[model samples]
Target: DTFTEDQICQVQEIHVGKPRIVATIVPKGSPFKKMMIYG
Candidate 1:
């Protein structure tokens, strides 16, 4: 639930030219979908 909110805020910040950075946290060796990710 909170993760979704964080992504939304990160995206909005990026759109507004904010210096905040957003990074994804995944388990080591985990495989992610071959698409753009906001989380």
Candidate 2:
């Protein structure tokens, strides 16, 4: 099955409604590693 860009975006809009907390992951040698925090 194949989905167009519009179709994929629509699905994401429904599922990714709200984000409580966001975390940025970086490489081990990078400045910031896997750091998680509350919302």
Candidate 3:
């Protein structure tokens, strides 16, 4: 999945004074996963 430029910009603005938003996609039984942090 991809985020539009506007969506990304909006998220960036919201992240300015707070901790970044972290997203993870894990399988049903996966213990390890990758995360994407945005600010």
- Top of the candidates by TM-score: 1
Better TM-score candidate (1, 2): 1
- Tens-digit lDDT string for candidate 1 (1-39): 356876777674235565788766766656562333534
TM-score of each: 0.32, 0.28, 0.29
After the best TM-score superposition of candidate 2, give how far the Cα of residue 31 lies from its true spot, in angstroms.
43
Give me the displacement of residue 11 in model 2, in angstroms: 0.5
- The count of backbone overlaps in candidate 1 is 0
Q: Over all chains combined, what TM-score does candidate 2 have?
A: 0.28
At residue 13, candidate 3 shows an lDDT of: 38
Worst 10 residues of 1 by lDDT: 30-39
Count of clashing residue pairs in every prediction: 0, 0, 0
Better of 1 and 2 by lDDT: 2
Model 3 Cα lDDT, one tens digit per residue, 1-39: 999998877774343585787766767655454332221
Error of 1 at 26 (Å): 0.3
Stretches of candidate 3 above 4 Å error?
13-39
